[model samples]
Target: MFRTLVQNVPAVADTSDTSDTSDTADVAVIGGGMSGMATALRLQSAGLSTVVLEAHGHAGGCAGYYRKRGFSFDVGATTLVDFAPGGVGAELLDSVGIAPLNAQELTGYRAHLPDREVVLHRDQSAWHAERLRMLGDSERHRRFWALLDRLAQTFWQASRAGVRLPVRGPADALHDLRAVGLSGVPLARHLNRTLGDALRSHSLRDDAALVGLLGMLVEDTVHTGVDDAPLINAALGVTIRGAGLSRHVGGMHGFWRALVTHYRGLGGRLRVGCQVSQVVGGPGHYRLTTRHSTLHARRVVCALPAARTAAICAGLPVATRLQTFLERDAQALGGACVVFLGVPEEEVAAQELTHHQLLQAYDRPLGEGNNMFVSVSASGDTLSAPPGHRAVMISTHTELSGWAGLDPAAYEQRKKEIGERLVGYARRAYPALGERAVIAQTGTPRSYQRFGFRPDGAVGGPRQRLGNTNQHAVPHDLGGPGLWLVGDSTWPGLGTVACVLGSRIVAEGMLREKGFAR
Candidate 1:
């Protein structure tokens, strides 16, 4: 059990005339995903005229949900971690004055490894006993875990205290200094290091079971394995269960509906089904052209992916770092394959845990159904399923290119094959998982590209190697004065919490750039 996410939404300050049809605002956020919406909400609350333009029919990008029959399937992300009080998501909700929707705080999930099953409990002592008893009980294991715990604590401190990246000014520098604190200052040394370095230091890098579990956590969170994931971030990722993983009552659907309502109630303009094809002009005033009209704004936050931003901002001055990131991750971007199933509750009745990560063979690489994450909606949660059924979503990391360049027949065949393969993998954990399902479908990289608007169907950020993440990750502030980027493609890359953190940084940066902050 965990603390609830029901807080009162404080009244938001009305910043602009909502009824104005001029398509002009003080700021224009290019996408309406989690990051874009959070940024625009904060800016609007701060009394800045802001508007959010989403290409999709509604918000929530990868976090978005869709319904088939009576089942609601989350498109990408399954849970919100570090979302309790004094956590990253808590700060964003508190800032926007929107109370979070009802959420079920996860106790933990069962990680079914080859050798044993480890329960990732949210409680400190339970998790300690579980990991040590399951992964390893030696001194080396203890030491590695101790280091990870310390690093995770340091990252959470910086996060909850409102850390911003790129250190835009003395103000930003001072904020980071205070947020990181003297006790945590030394931990910054871990930034350039990789999780492999930490594990090797403890002489536990060769522990296949331990490393495989880390790969499961980090690959899902930071989008990398133990060897390449940045030390500090991987630490946070591995410990997210401790920070708290909360699944909304209706999953992302309830969360987004409430958030969009809060934003609109605050008089912030949100234009759905509006795709901005070109962003021309900058250094103050800018013009965003969509099929409907050309919106004018003094500031523009290109919350789209790095590659898409590069494409649309042809006339505007794009940043060198952004282009560098686009090229660097063009072929390397990771996508996901998801299998959505709606089955009777009895199918999952044998499962004690609602969420599970199954790795059939630890020796096998993590992807293409080898490492599968299975999530079942809460029993009797009618918002996500029918009265006697539960919504099940199983997903795994995938190579985007594998799903590309195939003819129609080949593509359909490949999709069908992958879907069946994942369902087969899930059977090891939930024997009746997708049996007798009323609704079943598969989503591939091409599906993501079509529906999510991600370039080449890239899902999460880069593999989060030491070279491409942290300071080297794409900055929120592009070179142009009014230009900015926020999303999985940017710093603190990928995840619901990361997007909120990125939004906070961009909102603060924009306020300061517009002379609203000290």
Candidate 2:
């Protein structure tokens, strides 16, 4: 379907528009994260001249990587979901004609709770048996699991089939309904529900072990606790192990390098360190103001977080629209605390898998290192670290507000405490994780704000809730001509796979608007 979308469109033109307009293109992508890169490449392949303006010097916004002292660490998100054969990621790669990813297929990770360790296997039957053996084996447990498998299977397939959601109009409503098919009609009842609702229906709401496990998984994927996690969204979250989770052989560093190479090879323009400060004018005459220069494009796709998008498009009609959601997401916007360590391979080799999710205590609140995830690079992936060393990234969610208004001394003190706490928590999986680290550093919301250029360092979109996700999600078009939004902030929500799905929706819409498609 995508192979011929842009085959007849025109390529980028030579810019003789003077220093005032140093760059110009048929489409301009305002962020170089997964969503922006995907959309730009799709549009570029469709025959439109495209330029991607990234504030950061490198690619992959939250999913990006960094190097220090011969060690490379993924900044956020360790695994790629549903990228294997017939999955959304595979479809995207096929659509763009990029070679399939060289990722290490993972069996799954071990979840370390305060009292028990559960192995979440990728094999469906194995996971079914394991969950029954570990979490609960009652009929109610079976019913709950059955509901999740049903919803997850339904929606995951809809997404893979290119379902467009968060209906922006009558056309979208029809398109999405058809994409879902008649078989999925009954699943819509869950749209108004929460994961808690499902548990309640099964009379398992009080099951702390199960709730804690679900909470940890839900929070990581949807940025919300189980009670408030939208049912459909949570379904996809808890069952991702069954879908597939893989860490690139060289980690995100290798992933970004490959993506950028493919995009550039397609003749797409990538301007890093070029921050867009303002966007003015309208469709086919949009003006993007960057710190160093200005870029003009016929269309604009912003993959920025909502807050950053609001700031850059300050006075446009979309700014007001963005603000409404910004206020709704104000309390929901969260950040991350990451501890990157360059440790000896032995430290990580002791673990059964390269990834582990640790919940220090089921009763305690989730963040501030109580619940953390650890991702260690493959032992022989030399691109991530020195031959015998490995790069380890430990992350936990945090509300951005918690890190504000601190004195320098106080901030430093807190950063130390949280960083140490996370490292300590990670020890549950890799007992020797940080004992003899060659390099250890911590990052807070402020660190993300500084490096990722996100407003308040908001990492994921608003925590998925009944009112904030699914049919209520922020759509691609914000009532601005030629202005579009994609990324974690849009439909399908966070992670590599979600962003890629959003890219497909936005790219197709851009093409349709330009009459580049039927």
Candidate 3:
């Protein structure tokens, strides 16, 4: 059922610069994911010599893609929202000369609960109006909308101020406080509430549909439930209410390719396939020991996870703290996703599927097969199938801790069973899915580990619960002078936009500290 693998670009040259030219670089960014790439690009554009060391051959990390036959599949992420003009995400893309496609805007998400199915529209008025009309007037719905609006406004303001910078000590904390103080009262109030209390106080506790909605939001944002998450992080998802969802025209991989192109064009150096073995430090500089050679730089940004950062900084003072943070703060939430491609054109014609769909079995446990988020890369006008064929990607949240240490045969059996069950559940929404699938690929936690290098195949990094939501909770400070951290495990947490924003903030802080500020 699979076709030939197509090469998109020529192999990158091995950059094993062993000569000690006495030339110093401004910064060296480890990990070539969106966060690392964005940071390197921003620094280089400021005229600072930057080098991005990516273990993988291509850039984009989780945001990258691979091609099979004629189809391009986004292996890591698929959906994006809040890309409107002037938004940080949009501005970043625009600066890189990557424009959003004029594709059809998704109305909203469709929820398939065990009891019923509901289609969520992008228009707030329309969405609320429909809910009230169908479920009757409930004070819960009214209060929910009001809270959503308030939270959305506050988050929009905060995001506009630019992502917060890394804080080193009490002095940095005071600076951050001053910045927040200048923003005024609303910001303070918004950060003071927990998402759980917000929902319970509004009488939304008994509403299954409302719970499902908030649950999905929580899952996508924190990789956990609302009760365990902080109000500030949850508010980030609520704030995306009316912003139209977007996707790259070809696939998400197209977006990654565009970023690499822009970065290379700016005269930035990118070394791929060279694994960094150790990061050693001298009197005032740091050197990266890779398989081929060593790269010495004045400043280094550890853009990978805290665990991997610990591995690289073996001889550094912060190594112990980094390891602790990785164990406690960087614990992974287990989950797996399966991508289905090559469904014939005729089957897609019968089932009118859109670019996205959400399937749920309400009675099931939260981490089980209860909720499944699906996205189709088909044409905009038609939801079910791509222009001539059909492509579907489905994902569910599972605890990686539960699957660890299992025997190889048992692990394979579990994957096969889960894959079949998920496909069966999807068949209920699109009956034609049964006989139409021509290519099926199952990605277990092992697959994620193999491809993304996530330790336990944890797609989401560190749970955004109450105690771990603060600035210090993030391993950004590293407790050392020159070492820094940036990624999904850092402040602001998961999602492509959040990761990029966090990385930018770290880069800006480093620039300011090094006297490169405007």
Of 1 and 2, the candidate ahead on lDDT is 2
C-alpha TM-scores of all predictions: 0.94, 0.95, 0.88
lDDT of 2 at 387: 98
User: Which model scores highest in TM-score?
Assistant: 2
State the lDDT of candidate 3 residue by residue for 1-518, as single tens digits. Answer: 11221234324323433443434566788888878888888878777788888776567666665555455666666766566676667766665565564444566766675666666667878876766665447777777666766666656555655646445568666656654555444555655567787888887766776676667767766777777767777867754546556666655655665676677777788877656779888424888877766787877888886667777787887678766566666454556566455566655455454543454644445654556766667554232234577566666777786678989889888877777877777766666764756677666777667766777777656877766665546656563556667887777767777776776677667767644453
Question: Which window of ten consecutive residues has the lowest lDDT sum in model 2?
Answer: 1-10
Sort the candidates on TM-score, descending order: 2, 1, 3
lDDT of 2 by residue, 1-518 (tens): 11111121112211211344466788999998989998998988887889888777667788887777677778887888889999988888888888988889899999998889899999988999999999999999998999999999998888888888788789888888887788998898889999998999899999988998999999999999888999989999898888799888678877877777888888998877678899988887889987667778878999999888888888788889987788887888889999989998888897768788888887789988877888888888997899999999899998777899999999999999998899988887877889999988988898788888878888887888988888778888874558899999988889888999999999988888854342
Between candidates 2 and 3, name the one with more favorable TM-score.
2
How far does residue 407 in candidate 3 sit from its true spot (Å)? 2.3
* Residue 53 lDDT, candidate 3, scale 0-100: 84
Candidate 3 has an lDDT of: 0.66
What TM-score does candidate 2 get on C-alpha atoms?
Answer: 0.95
Prediction 1 TM-score vs. true: 0.94
